[model samples]
Target: MGIYKPKTYMVMISNVEPSTIHEAMTIPSWNQAVNDELQALIQNHTWDLVPVPTNRSLVGCKWLFKIKKNSDGCVARNKVRLVAQGFFQAARLDYHATFSPVVKANTVHQILTLVVSRKWKLQQVDVNNAFLNGDLA
Candidate 1:
């Protein structure tokens, strides 16, 4: 008889995320994720659920989910965000200004250049999300 080998089973994982609200609701852990998102929004004073104005147009909102993990390839946290669908926004009409916190490559280079010129140590740090810290009023 030939040498016997043990059977091995492997679990497959995909980067694909949920696309619909119903799909998210079906998962037990997703409920906690949704609740955590709402809590953060409320605590951050993100918005108020008031009656829609008769003469005002409001954009639609939806929940987006992401699974974040550390370097060890383990589940770190569930991130859920409420995103506004503003594709219909008109320039200089619906809104005058849009804000984004994306960092520019030039800006990063300049900052690093300054630190190197000054012979200062560079330490990575995380800052509060600008969207959350800004005054929406």
Candidate 2:
């Protein structure tokens, strides 16, 4: 019989630090905003959240966090987003229809004018990275 040998083991770690007390307190509030955005995206049918299945193709998402800052060097808030790994998707399988529509600045201006004339509260949201939420597979 051949000589017995023990298998080696390795542990990998990320080069990031844990949240501080200040950050810990602040993070949850920002995460709430992120969660709201994610929910809206789901409700709007922007993307589908599915399990990575075998023998078929699917994209993946990951949650990315970034600390936002104002020009005055103060921490504004934490921004989180979901992003897709688009490279893995097969073009033929994913791109059933490639029709896309574009809006000109004049159209946007008209819409804004209409909103203002209607005196409606126009709430705009800023989705940060918006492509990295979970793992691909």
Candidate 3:
């Protein structure tokens, strides 16, 4: 009888996400993601260059990195976001009230149920930078 040998297979995994901007900069994909986000923000006129106010405290911001995946569990793209450190802000001194608009899952389910029951055609729309379109007083 002849001895049988089992073959070894090698797999490559490359889904490691960087937790800091310094580490992200080293990777080309992450660097491009950061650039893309900056370009989008600039194109949308998200912010303008302004002199720092002497009386008010400036809010600190940080870069956030995320790996977006497709439904088939494949890496779709690298996503980056710049977000303010709201936890550092004083409650009464910095702002009067804080509100975030978000739809509940139950509400979405109810809406979809109604649409299905009424036999109505449904359409979906995705508005990029929709929150940035809000007017800041």
The model with the greatest TM-score is 3
**What local distance difference test score does each model get?**
0.63, 0.53, 0.69
**Residue-level lDDT tens digits of model 2 in 51-115:** 76665665555555566666896556555555555666667776532222233455557667888
**Between 1 and 3, whose TM-score is larger?**
3
Instruction: Show where candidate 2 strays beyond 4 Å.
Output: 1-34, 47-56, 91-137
> Candidate 3 clashing pairs?
none
Question: What TM-score, computed on C-alpha atoms, does each candidate reach?
Answer: 0.57, 0.44, 0.63
Candidate 1 achieves a global lDDT of: 0.63
User: Once superposed on the true structure, which residue ranges of model 3 sit more than 4 Å away at CA?
Assistant: 1-14, 96-131, 135-137
Any idea how many clashes model 3 has? Answer: 0
lDDT of 3 by residue, 3-46 (tens): 99999554332377889989988887788888878887798776
Compared with the true structure, the alpha-carbon lDDT of candidate 2 equals 0.53
TM-score, candidate 1, is 0.57
Find the 10 residues in a row with the least total lDDT in model 3.
128-137
Tens-digit lDDT track for model 1 on 1-137?
99999995543323446777778766656766777677766786766678976755777778887877668986655566677777756776665333433345565576778889999998763322223544322
The all-Cα superposition gives candidate 1 an RMSD in Å to the true structure of 9.4
